[model samples]
Target: MRPGHDFIGVGVGAMVFDDDGRVFLARRGAAARNEAGLWEFPGGMVSFGETLAAAVVREFDEEYGMAVEVGALLGVSDHILPDEGQHWVSPSFAARWIGGTPAIREPGKCTAIGWFRVGALPEQLTQASRDTLTAYRKKGPA
Candidate 1:
């Protein structure tokens, strides 16, 4: 049974910034689980018993080939993609890229990857990413 389809799922992500203060983002590809073609703060589903922070770290390592220093929680978002028939309760955090340059480690899940100043993000964004950005803006100066 699919986690988001069969029941509410838990996903985790991080807004990882480089020394230059640009956040990393990835465009979803055709094989993305949902919101294909939209850009998002890269992340993925949480494994059973994994801490949210650990999940965020693991996702960055596995999906972007980068290590991150997890910061405080950015916010929680209900990623209810009704049209796609998926629901996820996601907790996104603030993180700093500590090691390795970012790269698209999961080509099937991501079509493009880049770092951008928060103010100049791409127009099309995934629901969770939009929410994450909102929370980040509200936090301010961090």
Candidate 2:
């Protein structure tokens, strides 16, 4: 229940890991609706009637041109962008890369995509992404 936002939104995020242990991240484009220019794990709002795992799969495909095998749930976070008038409950999950190279499929939404080690992630990260990464790391490598 934040200002400028309508209903409470449910979202899903995936911490996609490559075989080499690098995690995929994307830089939000300037034209992104919220948290523009911040690095984040590729994800999006969950559509009505969609399962959280399904949302994670669809989000990876839509944002990174890749498919993911959704793994265990990492954690959940309250992503309240008060400045942008958005409130979201985001469930983050661990996933394994299944196919396709990361790409900037949505130029208006993401400016860049890359894989990084936990110790070497970009400085500017979206709050939700930061939270998810921390939770993932605390759980240790699977």
Candidate 3:
């Protein structure tokens, strides 16, 4: 794949929910590939031959320093960063925090991590991230 531009990178995001029904979010660092400095879920591009669920679980641990129980596929949306010339097909999941506290392991790509109630999400969010959360909300808290 070409990566950015015309390539549709396959991505996976973990909507890690705590017992209180709040979801984890990470602030994208200024040095991120696209849509930098925006709030988004912890995830990355899915590698070739990897399943979406496996990818989400792996990415959550890699980005947030925690393992998660990857649950249902909440939604899918296109992340088209026109100004940055990038595109991605992102599949977002409803995951449960299994272990470890959320931490920004990769400082270059992420700056902070925190849990937020569904109704109190950050205003500046990646379009795909926003869409995913909206989809999750439509289903209501379980």
- TM-score list, all predictions: 0.97, 0.93, 0.93
Which residue pairs of candidate 1 clash?
none
Model 3 lDDT tens row, 89-132: 88888889979977788899888789998788899988889988
Tens digit per residue, CA lDDT, model 1, 1-142: 9999999999888888989999999999999889999999988999998998889889989988899999989899999999999999989889999998778888988999999999999999999999999999999645
Off by over 4 Å in 1: none
Per-prediction backbone clash count: 0, 0, 0
lDDT of 2 by residue, 1-142 (tens): 4322787888788889999988999899988768999999878888878999999999898877898999999999899988888888889999999898778888998888889997899999998998898898789765
Residue 13 of candidate 1: its Cα lDDT? 85
Better of 2 and 3 by lDDT: 2
Q: Model 3 clash tally? A: 0
Give the clashing residue pairs of candidate 3, or none: none
**What's model 3's TM-score?**
0.93
Candidate 2 least-lDDT 10 residues: 1-10
Residue 123 deviation, candidate 3, in Å? 0.8
Query: Which candidate number maximizes TM-score?
Result: 1
Q: Cα lDDT of model 3 overall? A: 0.84
